[model samples]
Target: MDYIKLLFALLLFLVGCAGISPKPLSIDQRLAAIPRKDAPLEHKLIIRWNEQAVPYLEAGSDADLAFGLGLVHAHLRGGQLALLKRISQGRISEMAGPFTTKVDHALRILDLGRAAPQIEAALPDETRRWLERFVEGMNYYQANTPNTPPEFSLLGISFEPWTVRDVITLSRLVGADVTWFAYFSLLSERRKGQTDEASWRRLIATTQAGAPNFRAAENDSQLLHDLLRASGRSGSNSLALAPGRSQSGGALLANDPHLGVQLPNFWILAGVKSPSYHAVGMMIPGVPIFGIGRNPGVSWGGTNMRAAASDIINISDLDPAGFSKRSELIRRRLWPDAKREVRFSSWGPIISDAELLRGGDGETLALRWEGHDPSDEISAFLGAARAKNASEFIAAFKSYAVSSQNILFADSSGVIGQIMAARVPLRSTSGRASFIRTLDEAKQDWSTHLATPQLPMQLNPQKGFLASANNRPAQTNLFPSSLFSDDERVKRLEELVLSRPLWRVEDLVQIQTDVVSRKAPALRDDLLSFMPDEATKRHPTFVTQLKSWDGSYAASSRGALLFELLLSEVAHKVYADKKGRVSNAASQWSYLTAYLKTDLSALEPHLCKEILQDALDKAAKRADRFKNWGEMHRLPTQHLLARLPILGGRFTLADHPASGSRETVMKTYHGLERGLHQTSYGSQARHLSDLSDPDLNYFTLFGGQDGYLGSQNFADQVPLWENQQYVRLPLREDVVKAEFKRVLVLPN
Candidate 1:
């Protein structure tokens, strides 16, 4: 009776625990609790995951094991997403790939025409096992690996299962691979005829949509069908699928992404601990574990870089009058495909196919990413996540994967570093920075370029710091289409780093969080001009706040908010037209003023208006607009996941979320909220990083550690991150251990 009274009192103290409190449970024990093969999707998912993944998570790092719970939740929720990813064989065979297409064609036959006969007729005698493996692995892992059980915790930091629906919230985060518009060709192309004045806005209202099962075979099949549209006379391309790394530090990354976001955005957290090492980070469901994390001696993080483009060629349509000049038809392969059928649940052949690009061989190629080959990005990251030095980390680099990212490393040995890690295609110049792009293998070896380790750098610079704002590499001057903005940001970083020595992590954090006017120093003249001493009476109070504050743009600061508002108005009018007014990168805006000084007379009327309209508007309504940045730069998850036909033919789209706050991996806004544009959504995943590293971390869609809705973490870290503030990445505490409430031991 006395003990019961004490226990009851303690419950209130620990009231924040939303789910079942974890008790002591071993890997084998957790596996034993789930039923084996033939179990329902939910149960089969449980058994497969607890059987395989739990062993890795439990055996790996502690925080890793905790984060693994997100994988676990994904698996548990896999029934819907997985079932959705599965598609009809008819949809794929029409796709025109032999090995995969034939197998899928047979798979549909087996289902509709009956299994034994279909297999006998369609697949070779030896490959049935491969098909089985694919089916089983896809279903089980999708539903079970990222499982978040129906439990919760009060202390927001730990790993816990997600509710069935929370797993659905993972979509916005999965689409992070959109590369930067690197070169002036691409940038100017996107920037061409672009309005001088723009606002960030979205046509679709996405605040309440559900999730999609994109990785499922059905989804992949549908994706292939969609790719078939441009398949005519196109060549097929495939990657070697091997992973590589920098020659420094030990780091492993499990860079799984959480694609769409609403109230809460999430990923699994797992912890692996041993005296020699401990690592924690995220993992993806329906796939092997990890893309980024930390090991004992090394800590690392990464961002995306698209490094594929052709060699150099300066070809001109010369001598058009004569047929004697052969139209330089370089011999090569081109991938092409025939028209295909797509099975729509309600409408047959929902999406028609067209050949997109043909290879030199006139063969059609699949729409696969360069790094998506069965590579070891996970293993490479695992190796680097715990690396102790440059030498050891380079070894880990051998297995790195996914879209390219600029990795930054910091070790316990008082070393700080950065590496633009990716297989950037090779380049050649006609003795100048600007040159034509070519695909001639004889002259340029784009496929065999050196690793990211060989790129430019300030290795252990005199100043104890290194930074990257997705800028161009240090060794080059031209902003190649293969990469972007590296030199500008890199130069700026070098200036700041070399400016000071012995930077405290706090100082680095300040640098990482710096969001003041990248254009402010130049704007001083423009601002001062408006600072009529007598007219100062009409000056908004926030202007005074901005003038008094340091240049840092912390999210919650009044000055940061004011600047964001000013920019939002500008950005909305400049690009994507999501926000609809003004919101260019502060740094770019700074440069524009200089350009304006020299080119104002040559500027288009629209461009002229862009420069003056924003300051004019803010100056006129500084008090209202400058109240706070959040007013213009909101932390809203704009798109919702809804139904789309194909695969399970059931899923939602997270609509156009563009140009948001800086903390957001990619900024997003739709003209105030459903601004001008088409109604459909856009799914683009640009940045991928888990907060395992301090300097260059990608916080949550909502920012930081946990993203359980209704919990403090749901929106708790938004402002901290929006303002570029940060929460601590907790190292293991002595008391924190995996303690399951009930132990169920299983056979090894």
Candidate 2:
């Protein structure tokens, strides 16, 4: 779908159109104007702001650090933090427009708002203290600030004092099992005509954990839209090469988490110093601690395990005897005065089931997801943030009960490993059926957990490195996980890592930006074999370009564009009847591979010529305008309001031509529309940590730290990020102090 449509929907989601745009707050202005009461206690610590507005927080105690971190967040990212909390608690509709009604309904069904309290209660006292202080910091910032955060002001919403539960709710959105997999699973099943109870059960029993792709589509289902809006491609590259393989004689870890491009960016960088912990890395706005950063001895990064943490069950018939139903009043933005009752069954949200169904089949589809329950997800990563070594890191994960993460750990002690961490469910005989039908089939529960001892872990493998990019857990499985990403990315990563005997932080960045498409080589070879002499002669430049191409989707390479066009055309022609079956290039490759296995005639000269000609003609029209791939394959960071055509320029980040394809190590996946690939989803955060010097961390978020349009930090990192140029992130107090631009000393 075009971004304009998305923006239109977003505009509706934000609220009824208000022509008012809030003036951006200058960083200097904000810091200089800090109220005395809101200022940090004089003896407590110093809060330094860097030139980029990244916080360098120092405090006497961990609690104080957390408090200062909260203040910094409120000062810079308070609007973002509040938005996340609101969205998680299904309150987006309260501030956003009527468009968010379905999303709000979906959230209410999952009951994240109610579950937040439970999650908060599950946190250990120590963790709770850290969290409480963080909230207090935000509340303090709010209480003292003379003006609201710019985003909040633009939306005309007043700031609310945050609770610990709000923080829990924010963390849960990241760690929860809320996925679009269930909807896709059911859609695939329905497409297969397996609507019958017995067929449904059989399908569920037959299909393994890695059954659904969860591909994006134009579906009117609110669940689909909400999930698509809230989430991006759930994959990342996290690898730690042991000291043996590094030139520095220290393990090097590289991590790039691929997610949807959002307004104001998702991850923010912060440097924290306190008596108990002093570290620097990315801090999720609402959550405490440096989420994916290095501590003193150990550095950790994570990739989505993409585990089968959810299933959709078709409850065609329910027994009235034992079932219970609950009704909740839902007030929507469109009809603020009106209240509607939404009914829910014990299984899940029945209202969503009705809304999602195509026809009134009387069959209720219940989403049984891991995230629906109250969890200690917040505690898991927080514990990880405090971990000192490999042993501690592993132990910390034992408490992780949210969605699975393929965690890669490397420490100064020369320990490098990968651990599949999450509350992996050991499905029962019936529960093993990921796609279930009927109450009988869904009755079985997931009682046994995949214990820490059983979870997939590789400690300093002989190869001297451990990596995961949403691939299969291991050669052997502790529990069946849905390996969504094909081994293309991991294979490329392994190739790059193994080929380079000695790895450096720069080498890791190169790998992160690697764009060599695995499928391209084979596809090019096949196309060359089928190219007619006459057509080849007519398009000599095109033929030559293909022959000499290295297969990297670099912006300047005309071959990459031509190849992509041809591939898309051929795939569409071959699978025109089977829509959504071979939509992606990977699926196209699979189809082409199968066809090649049988006969070569499928790609004979005539059909190949037609596909190539069509692609060439389309390319010729656009090729004259673009000098390099970047011009066409522009990566525009999204701002919530940027979707509007006129205001898009304001919300959109300065364009940087991004390299890499869907299958590349860089993995810049985007929508291919209007003969150009406009990047929408890709790496949101990239980090390279040298265990030799924990302070020698190279990291970049897709956007700057500040979400407020007024702050100078907003979109400040785009140029560096676009060029893959990483600024040094100093974790040490001395280094931060040296580079510090401003200081705020709190009063005791």
Candidate 3:
């Protein structure tokens, strides 16, 4: 009897463990479940898959191609697609349970889908037909396919049909103003009592100094932007080389978009051929357009313009009766549905009603974002994908409304250009540095808007190369906010571009992976100069390493680790307030370094020396804990599900040594954690296209092509990304047919 009881206990334990980490179906198992020989379609469509699981869809008509793409996307990333739709619609709580209530509340307040219905109504007839077919394909897959992704059952997600509104909503989600990140960071600091006028002025000045110009030649909370980052929205780096600067004598384009490090990357690799669209490149899973890709006439990429498309307006003085209120029912998986009230003002939504803005201290604030207005990003991207020249491409984005971008292009004509693509709100008062506006000011300031031709643009600059890395353009007056990234990445790109007279596709690849930091060396030199003699004598080995170190943040770099630790210590000491709390404004490395350079020089001689010595001592103590930079700076390739207790480790795709710093051209952003730190944001996908040959396009995703958990292709492309290698996706039909062997046929 005792033996039987013990056996029963062990059996129950094993079953519970299995339930925690439920195994997903194999790729073969999932694919076998789907009908391969035929499908419900308007025309015959052929789908071919490469060894890496990248799909190439060929169809008789544009609508059919759209349907085929929807089928392929659903087959590979059905779970991700479902989750994203829920997120965009503020319905995640219905699937994930009570923990996501706050998230749903925030999303409801932001109302990402506010303009979706209007945008859909205004869509061109052709685009609408394409979108409807895509929706049909997705619904067909969901209805017929069996053995779907395991996450669906685990999360209790219903297999809902896809809609055009869902696509528009997802676009808005991706284009959530990046400026909100700056706003949240600044607001958090203000909540910490750093709200004095002098502090605000100093912070604004330091931020402005970091902006770089392309023409010249240039959050932490579970806030909306935080959720956006988790849903894959972040910065990027893009460069275009005119024929004169290219070794191939053909224009070349290189792009690497940055996003939070996670499994099942935000992008999918695919090629589509149809009457209206013939392009090969990356596409956001739910969105139908190819965001970064190359067509027969041009290759293109983009970086976020960091446009001030929204403003936080203080409505504290406004009458409460004027506010509009609506009740939203938030359903949780295992709990009773809760009704929450969402308030809105004439300006926009009362964003302060969300926990994200609870720090507003009794003040009521509404967020007036350009995304709330009716606009068609779908038409803009579709137009861009079909554009045959620089002028057409520029005109395509004339009505682009939000998530502004520096759209860079390299055309078949060897013409390279950049256009600021966004409908920016023109402030009534020029040079308004504060992100927060008074209610009266908000009503008047944002009355006018600027579109494509009115925004700053450049065509074939004298330098023969154009690049954007979230830098301020040459015309600062055109943008309302100066919260741009420091010029480290852009400056490095310019250096590499001008390093030689001409460049090849291979050279651009090298530039993309370059980890050298110009700011690091400059900051190191400044620190060394201020170091006390006694401190250097005490830590001879540390001083020697710093002196001999170049600014390369390679995996094996010991000097890089030491420099980072020292910088963190120095920043803390320099920016600490009277209460010993360091300002969040200095959290930006560029601002910290700039502030230190100026402050160190102006400080009393003895005080500067003392601070330097103290910082060195602290850094040396921490440096003793790590063997090299890679040991401390790691890339966290874990899915959000990794937060699940005991089985979390199973969800982690990879946590390995990584190179690059916050400001390096190859960005892997880390903070001032004392010992080991994991990088949360960095390059997630890379694309390079040489217009010389139809087969010269190369691409790689930081994660993989397939989003299925147990699929062998899930993280297959990670090695290629890490090694700076690429998969050649050719536009030539013969080459594509020869390369992709696995096939599926869909018949009308």
Candidate 4:
């Protein structure tokens, strides 16, 4: 009887541990559980949605088109837009909880919100009115739409009226990401203790291109770390062909802005038309104009012009009178009584000691970011959207003040041009210095900027082709403080362009997705020469694979995978600096390729053969795990909700097998900090514009436009984008109206 009682007690404990089961619903009940909404169109404006739900807005005026853009943007990406505004305002913790408190703190220090009102007040009346109309449209969408994205309901947050300041804030956020202030900070710290000044200068000259700068070291706190990680590491490709070089007797332009891959892509496809003009391209959600696209006969696209627009100042004994003190109450949903005070000097916001080190003489450090200063980039893009020809487009480039970009222009008149548009700081006479270590030294910095004429620009170059892959604009006259990308991409681009005589738009697209690596063949030759008889006998399969490789990182090529692994291992063995906490040599292809081709005496002592043999054995093992390269080289499209176990799988775009290594023109690059072959960064958007037929302009995004889960358009582009397919971005209004499935009219 006692044994029976014990068994019964054990069963009860088991049942209790199991917990109550969640209630299950039948199919009928599940069908009925869907959320209902009543969203009707207003009468003032007309919106036509394509089969993919991309909106085409036709308004009586430009302001109305702005209103329509805001309305559609709010409906499709309300959650993302709201979150961006919240983050920029340093109010993310109010909705996202404690995890984002650090992000909030960093944003508060950056203080784009404080600078927004002043920026808005000083804007031209035309730009200001357009922004106002955009705000009204967003507000109207919020009032009329009965339902919001599931994320809002899950977080228990509601959308608020977006102000024009929010638009300015978005631009500031973009500027912070693309700016290189934190890059110089890390480079400065890394270059410390180098006694040989000449060697240091030479090292700067050699390694400045492709710094391989990551977000931050693992030990870093969230503030400086976030700043380092803001822009993340990215590269781009852009080119234009003159009429003489084109197969169709018209110019062609191509661009693919490489950015951190994400779902609900950083851009949205939109077509806006008013009586004044027509524009179409990938529009950042909050901004009114298409950042890279065409209007009528003119088409334009850009790459981040890696300009030196930010600086870190070491303040030795700052005067309190020259600054303002404020306390930012970091509101938290989870943590209570969390408040902190921070100070800002005349230079900029002071970096906290916890985030970065203070000077030795009881000094603080401040960051003077050019983005905080008021400038008008929005007006420039708006003007560009209305530009009809090459000269008009070049005129629009003159007013750009904040962000730097390499603009490529092609028009109906057979003209091709390039503009290095940026608010380039007129550095002091000694501005060639990479580090400005004293606050007094940087006090009068950026006092003057390069005038529009001073900016490097060319129209119809005699070469018949112009290209920029974030490379040095000119061999001699580069921007004084520019940190250009590695020259390999540009060199390879020139080879491909020069090799071809008569180019077509299709040929340009082929170049955009080209996977041939210039360094691979030479490296393969070196490995063959280094292989000993013993290695050749033991690793015959590896030797055979290496010999058979054509150097293209095609998905089926196992040799490409093996070579990438071998290269990474060799880099680790060769450039592992004991003093520098991080080694960036592995990701710097130009440096590594150059080093490998040099004499054996140049290599680390006793490492050349030893490292090669070890890498071969490891590669053999790694090779066995995968049937081919496609199985190993995967592109992981991480989503914000991917952190959640249940929702993660649902939100993430399908992990597709990606081709191309860091050295390829297809150019999917990953950091050495992460595991090799992990596709973290690559081209997020690709465009091929044909001047022969403007309506035939084709482009693709890594993902689709919609951010909402229920929307079919969400993640719709992934399959085609992965397959290197592009959809038409029709320029004609009649075609757009015919392709659309739904029409929405807004009340004026």
Candidate 5:
């Protein structure tokens, strides 16, 4: 049946493709089409491209460098940037038609860009000028460039001029709070009528056990979850080694940001050399700042702190006269423009008004997030980029507001430190509390804010290294966040870091790609201990293979495949409802792993035994279909457009065997579907820098640098990334000139 549906979809795609024209230009042709010599610039700037299309920009002033970066971003990622702007502004329905109307409605309710104009107005003089120049460069490229990505034509999008407000809004979109995913997971279960006290307690306990941090009592709206997922901004792993712990006798920094696996990758590799700014690292497509990279004195990387930056308020008791309301006309590509009504309370936007979250009970819920306030993340990152030392770096983000992070940095002066870079709210209830609060409770709790200085910071801890994999940081007077990622990845990193007295860059690379699962072995042993003797006899070969397994999610391991299948079956049996349907909420790996860790004897041991026996029997019957884990576990590097059946195959860059599981240090996230599954989220880009030498920096992306379809540079780095290799991005001018031969000089 699935095959037949696929065939029908393919037929439709073929019929549609017959009418499409003016195919996207190749990378070389696109480069040729760009205004190389006559680009609008205040000073001579050179953009040198390497074999993989990584650009090294050199300019006399920071303004020109910003302009050149804008041009480079627009030329390579115009489609992605355009899509991001639309997403940020709640205008995706304008291009994708009615299919995205609900998405647009949700975005409108959340108003992710509400703070952009205020942020733009308050920017420092130099920062405002910097953004103005950057916008100018982006608009110039859009107006002058002859090539347009195929997506623009296919989606019927008209590229518009860039603005500072647009830049700030996109920044807000990229930094949207990631904790909302966990929140939605918990709340969606409640919305489904699983609101019994015992069930709710079990759900919260299981979630907390796996992640081990503060959790919200109230559930989150789904709009923020969908937005963050679409934006491809998720968790990350970052570690900084002190000079004493490094073989090079200088601080070392390594980072790998986990994001949704797709094409045109989340990051673009770039190096900048100007009077005020000098650095090389990963830059987000639309934003003009080095998110993770190294300068002459310091190298820095960060993980999402998962801070409780927002709260859902129940304002049903509030007076309707106090609520502000507005309506927006949502434009659809081929369909008629639809009208959406957005409501706002004193706390924030009324999220319950959106079509996606309309509770029949007529309860009013508003989202009060720090992101709604005007904050200068642009100036923060800009300041950090040019900081000369650790103190300066720490001071740079004093005004940073949303998407709290644990920033780890290493400096050439033998300094290593971690700083909680966020403007945290000082709540009356300090510890973990329910996310959804009554209007009065919210008014009393959320009164003031804490700057970076008041937040947690470790300036050279005794451990000689700092690491964060979206895990809980050291607790201080005020806890940074109520929720965080599972501790398995951070534990694995600590174990590896402690295994060696002093580490080299090569040694750290091994840690970055480590595929061993810390949670798998314990879970596997628990299952084996509970297996019925008769069931073990029935699946002797499977039991033997499982026992011999070492808990490594190596692609070729048959044991890994068998273990995962058994685990999946066990979760299904244990979490089944009265009708025998497994509740997805309880069956999630995060909850299942934690639930299994508890004493089965304390919670119906006989039932657990029967479930285990049945699970083993079921898994054994299905174990013969595949040879190894790799056959079932795949890394899909395909764009969203790949859903279009026939031509979809062309959009798919690569579908190859992948290593690592959701809990492994090298995270490749998948669900228990009982058959072949592709990784949905994992390491998108990697950056490592040895501060001892400016030339000892390396970076790689899961996909390629170019966003154009069918470009040679698209997905060019996938093999290098799979093999754990990196491209050398040197800071020295001599090395840069020697390595990058293709140069596009923009004259004044």
Candidate 6:
């Protein structure tokens, strides 16, 4: 289907006109429930008067939903968009309106650049101007949303250049399993710079116009709106905008957005009012809605699940005159911009040279790829914030403009939504577009994309239960997981949680917090493949320790001593080429086979000498010199606390921070030492967000409260986040009432 068409369908899912009911906790109660008590209210500060009163956020008897909603509403109106939403709702929160029809226009064609402007130019000038406003709305948020830090860094290790945008974009490029934004950027800076940052930035800007591009939202399911408007006669179902009550008779909505860890882990909260709606969220400074907020009965969040390539470019030593002329032929065909210009700093190919080719000279060649993905990476949240049910919730998904995410929803209607919504490209095994997994680059080709209709979903299952441990889908009917099978995190989540029944949100949270390492069992199984009989029995103590102890890498365990020995043995054999430097890009099996020789050596000084004898025999078949894996593949971690040459240099690669223990998270940031790894840390920051809903319903980041560490609410949360943990945020009015901290009124 056309990418635009899918977007049109998504756009048509926006909420329809429905009257919302009013529900609010007392003014005292709200104050007690504030997520950060130290941060003073904007209204309370004499120098900066709040435009509105905070008490009216949920003001029931006095609420006039329409009285406040307007096209232009923000701090000027006193409350932020999230606060406005707290008081506003229609009889129902439906997703349907003329605005969606315009969305369908872009969805009708795959290339928004080609379709939107051409179609709009043919329209009356006034009509075109009206349409541009909404586009401006999106850009406004993108440009103005404060760049905040993630709630915290893990292990005292913080990423320096890992932008919130990089988190969302990389998630789209790499599968959610990888977290190497800063790593990739640091290592690939030379090549990415060779590719040209200005041109790349411009290319990204074009996709932001809400146009339907293959890269914009992968396929159409990620589009926020569909280009095809559902005519009145079309009779398609609309998202249920009416407030829904769950079995407990409580209004519900679930949102799990994917974002990064930054100084500020979330958007700033602002209240918005319009004749059409009242909502509150981090209004993002200039944006009209609270991207992550709730109107009494509705609220939302996101979790990253973007899918893309995770490989790096490799350099070669072959002279231009040597071997295959096909390299020359391919370069000629691939790069037509022989005279393309390169700005001072760049990566890969020049923008003017759309045709990327291998540049010769002893210098080396450049390549491009999707980097690793992270967990936090969502660009937008407001549309879903207003959704009332699964269908409408999906409509909000139409804007799938942000990064990849698996959105979970629950509403007062007892309806629930669990959708894997993202901009995942269909790649072949060789790392290019294709329907089949073929490593042959010559055979790969882009396939037609899916539309909003193609969304991967499991709504209101008969089991009345759903969970996401940031894993691939359990519903076998869906396409291949954006991730691979070897991912330990996903594997564990599936084994422990999906194997059982999950009914409540707590069940899901339990699975998420599961830090138990089943790695010992997996390693044991790998070891079982070999018997002790294979040992030479020369080192009685070595054999005794291996056989008697369980395979555990606990910090204090001697097992780590053994494991480190194995690593050293294996690394020494695989990384040492003829020059004694590192270079083992050959077959992984060769490295593994050579490393096994070390284990044999460890067993007996000479009893197992045959393993090395056999490895030497195998090397005769290859042209390259020998090397060890450890010499070439040192664990490269983005640790901020380290001060080694490889660890402290703006971008280091020699020594790794600390990893490889099954319990410790580890990922490969592939690239050679040639300008590889510029940013030592990484591009992602993570934080689990939840509003003051008492249920851990909100998350945020950045230098909130003007960078104040002592007085700002944002400051206190930083420490908890630095530890990769969370604190409570109860949204109950009663809780707020009892511990009432402070209150201010937002004026309309």
lDDT of 4: 0.66
lDDT of 2: 0.66
lDDT of 4 by residue, 638-680 (tens): 5554543233454555677778766566777654321335575
Error of 3 at 139 (Å): 1.2
Kindly report which residue pairs in candidate 3 clash with one another: 213-218, 214-218
Estimated TM-score per prediction? 0.51, 0.87, 0.93, 0.86, 0.93, 0.46
lDDT (Cα atoms) of all candidates against the true structure: 0.32, 0.66, 0.79, 0.66, 0.78, 0.29
The best-first sequence of candidates by lDDT reads: 3, 5, 4, 2, 1, 6
Question: Could you give the C-alpha RMSD of every candidate to the true structure, in order shown?
Answer: 15.7, 4.6, 5.0, 6.8, 3.5, 17.8
Candidate 1 structure quality by residue, lDDT tens digits, 274-385:
3334554444432223444454455555433333322222222222232211111111111133232322111111111111111222211121123222233434554565
Model 2 regions more than 4 Å off? 1-25, 33-43, 178-182, 185-215, 219-233, 320-346, 351-360, 427-447, 528-538, 578-628, 644-649, 671-674
Q: Where does candidate 5 stray beyond 4 Å?
A: 1-27, 195-227, 230-232, 430-435, 579-585, 588-590, 603-605, 644-647
Winner by lDDT? 3
TM-score of 4: 0.86
lDDT of 2 at 12: 49
Model 3, span 1-748: residue lDDT tens = 4464355434433434433354655555655655544576667788888888899999999888988888888888887888788888888777656656777887898899888888999888988987888887887788878656756655666588888888889889988887666665556555554644454556567554322111000021433444676553457899999999888989999999887667778889999888888899999888888889999998888988877788888889999899999999998766689888899888888877876554447878888899999887778888989988878888888668878888899999999999888888887654454658887778787888888779878989988999898888657576666567787889899999999998888778889998998778888999899998999999999999987889999988999999988988887787767876555455557666667788888889999999999999999999998889999999866665565434456678678898998878888887665679788677878999999887899999887888877777778888898888999999999999999887777762
Candidate 6 ranges with C-alpha deviation above 4 Å: 1-302, 308-380, 423-447, 462-485, 498-510, 524-715, 718-725, 730-740, 744-748
Clashes of 3: 2
Better of 1 and 4 by lDDT: 4
Q: Which structure is stronger by TM-score: 3 or 6?
A: 3
Tens digit of lDDT per residue, candidate 6, span 300-383? 443444233222223333243332211101111111212212211111211111112212233333222221211211212444
